[model samples]
Target chain A: MDNLKIERTKSTPYIFFDAASGRLRVEGESYPENVVKFYTPVLDWLHGYFAEGADNITLEFKVAYFNSSTSKVFMTIFDLLEEYVTTGRMIEVVWICDRDNDVSIECGEEFKEEVEQLSFRIEAC
Target chain B: MNIRSLYLEEEAVLKRAEGLLMSQQCFSLDVYRELYEEYRKLLKQMKTLVNVADLTQAELKTLSEELGKVSRIDGLTELYNRRYFREIFLHTWQQAVEEKDILSLLMIDIDYFKKYNDTYGHLQGDECLKAVAAEFQRAVGHPEDFVARFGGEEFVILLPHSDAEAAIDVAKRLLQNIENLCMEHSASPFGQRVTISVGIACRCPTSDVKPNTLLDEADQALYKAKAAGRNCFKLYV
Candidate 1:
């Protein structure tokens, strides 16, 4: 599978998903003008990656802020991770938040609860 | 004079005065006094009307100004509003193009907001929107970045000299922040958590393309995100 690279914008984040290392990293503030358009390719890439039966996926999310709409996209990513984990592939999600932001910490917790199979960690960055 | 006779006499005197005035004869000082009194009374009434008209005009001007202020403000989030957004967007876009800087936009919407509003009361839904708006404001920290509550549960963030990568980082942070809020809505299909969908559009502003086109592209990206799922970010190619 080819690597997935997304350039960030003022209203969105940069996404780098490496198929070989199974490492996916997203970093930036996200409040896109159009949420679906920004996230679709990422979602499609994830779908294709999972279909390829990738192993040992490490997804790191370093976000400063995302609007409610972007939260839904995060959920989709988590859902994909969960699917991979259920299929016996190892999945790790690292959620990075600012040290003082209680909000990001809680967001990580929410994802942790939703995806049962994937290992989720909340880190202060 | 007797009271009745005095009234008649007064009437007769008034008639005589009228006759004298009609004949252009010299009038009594008393008659002149009476005419002056009548003139004064008429002048007083006219003066009152004029004062009332002036006050009414002043009040109207004040009301019009207040209305203008209200209309200028964004109704939903009470932000600087969309009218201001257009002015700033054009200026920022122009500046970016001239400086050869990247201008990025994020169009965001509350995921399943309509459903959320339907399930919870509009009051609760409004609270959700307020919380989201506050989160967006915090995310776009740069002085040059313009964040406006565009409409409904949607918002737009404009970042000047910001590339796609920088915007994505901001978007991710915002996504994580809202998740942390832990506001529960059981009715949400996305689980107890409330989420959003974002669309990102970035380019060096150019003479050929208007800012609205960039916004439209971002909006298109957002639609793709929604189509794929309730939560996520999609970027315009």
Candidate 2:
């Protein structure tokens, strides 16, 4: 599976997935006009990575702000990872939040609570 | 990966899902339960997202208001800056005209401030300016009165409903306050202690009279005050 790389915009986040290292990173704001259209390639890359029999991967999320549609996309991504975890794959999810932004920290905590099987950790910086 | 190809692939998946939902006649009890749980989780996430956005919006509003106030204030003296003063001065002038009240402007300068800076160094000169600014702030008791840093070593006070006599009383009070401070200004020819020169201009503003007219008159009076001698005030006749 080829790695996915997309630059960030004023209302979107930067996406980078490394096939060689099995590391994925999505950072910055996410409020794109068409949320589903923007994240389609990212969802495709994740599906392909898991289908290619990848055993372990680390996903990092450093999002400052995101709209409701972006929230739904995040829930979908979490469901995908949880499915892989239930199939006996190790997936580590790290959510990085700003220390001063209580909202971002709270959102990360909410996501962590929703996923049981996946190793989801919230970190503040 | 080609983005177009990936987008097409996801579109196909979405179409398939739509078809599955359309064709499905009934779902098993376990499937229904799982869907209900997912719906609840989504609702909870949605609530958090909305709350986060609201808080961020409110925080941004407060930050912008604070930035506005900071921009209008002088950093060293904590007085209204010249630009902001100019904006509000016009409003004050208009209000005085509408009310048919006397408006007075006092142009004040520190006597031989350059010499003070040279003798005591820039740091002490800054302290002197701050002290004088504080004294001016304390002396202006009226709620409608405004004090501003007109520029380097110069300050202006706007007095509403005051005539020449009232303006002179304010000048006297300011001079007395500076004397109480008793700041040493060895290089000043005016006196051993720091003193200020004030120029007073009073008028009942009219619609035809521009706001700048009063300001110019005050400036001219300040020049006369300096020429006559420092450390005292002179009223524009």
Candidate 3:
């Protein structure tokens, strides 16, 4: 499997997925003008990898700010992770939030509560 | 496994990627082609969606601009309101002091306006105020000159980089403009028509003075104009 590296822009976040090492990460602010357009390929790649039946997956997130549309996309990704874990696959999610920003901390906590199948941890930075 | 830059969405490039992934392990060539084709269809759909988003963002920008303009305007006079006037004058005062340039202010009021409002009803009084405000708005000649509705029956004009002479010219033009309109005010002593009293103040702004100082000087001059009899302009010395 190949590693996926997408560069960050003013509106979109950086994505670095090392499929071989099983370390996937998304970092930076995400308020893209076209949320669905920006993230469709990312979902496609993740689904492709999942088809091969992964043993263990660790997804890390370091998001500063995101809008309503981007939140919907994040929920979709969480749904995929839930599906993966339900099949007895080991999936760990690490969501990073700045200590001073309560909104982001709340978002991470909500994700933890909502996605039951995955082991989700909120790490304050 | 090779690292790939993921922005590229060409069909040929995606097909090659699918070939590489299929070569890795279990995916057959036919299955890989189907996956690649599906991805290509998704990219085309995203392009269409992005075009729609661009239109929505443009409309949002226009709406915000209109809202900002509305906030800065006085609804009755259709001129810049007191808050916007104060915000701009403070900055202009600072700039004038830094550059050591001249600044002028004109504080104007309608003669016997309270009596006029009493005699003609508040509705007609509002119409008279609107007409007078339009005259003052027309008298402002330069882009740097601004006129604002200061309060009931009072208006203020700010002229940046204007000397005493230029300000007097503006005052004269404002008097002529209002006179030409010939708005009726039966309660006025100045004339049969509504007329305005103006007080002019000018300063080569310095670090020691503030915006309120200019306003106070103009107010004192306006009092002097009233004492000297209405329908005339007084310059603060």
Best model per DockQ: 2
**Tens-digit lDDT string for candidate 2 (B142-216):** 988889999999999999888898889999999999989989989876558999999999999999998999999
Clashes of each: 71, 0, 0
Report the error of model 3 at residue A4, Å: 38
TM-score against native, each model: 0.47, 0.81, 0.61
Model 2 segments beyond 4 Å from truth? A8-13, A28-38, A64-76, A97-107, A110-117, B1-35
Badly placed stretches (over 4 Å) of model 3 are: A1-125, B1-28
- Just chain B of model 3: what TM-score? 0.86
Chain A only TM-scores, each candidate in turn: 0.93, 0.97, 0.95
Interface RMSD, one decimal, each candidate: 39.3, 6.2, 11.1
Best by lDDT: 2
The alpha-carbon deviation from the true structure for residue B53 of candidate 1, after best TM-score superposition, in angstroms, is 18
User: What lDDT would candidate 3 get against the real structure?
Assistant: 0.83
For candidate 2, write residues A1-125 as lDDT tens digits: 77889999999999999998989999999989888789888888888888899988999999998876677677678878988899999899999998888877877877787677999998898
**lDDT per residue as tens, model 1, B115-177:** 889889899998898888788888876998888878888888888888899989878877877
lDDT (10s digit) by residue, model 1, range A1-125? 89999898887888999899898999998888877777777877888888787888889999876765566566556655776688799889999988877656666665566556679999986
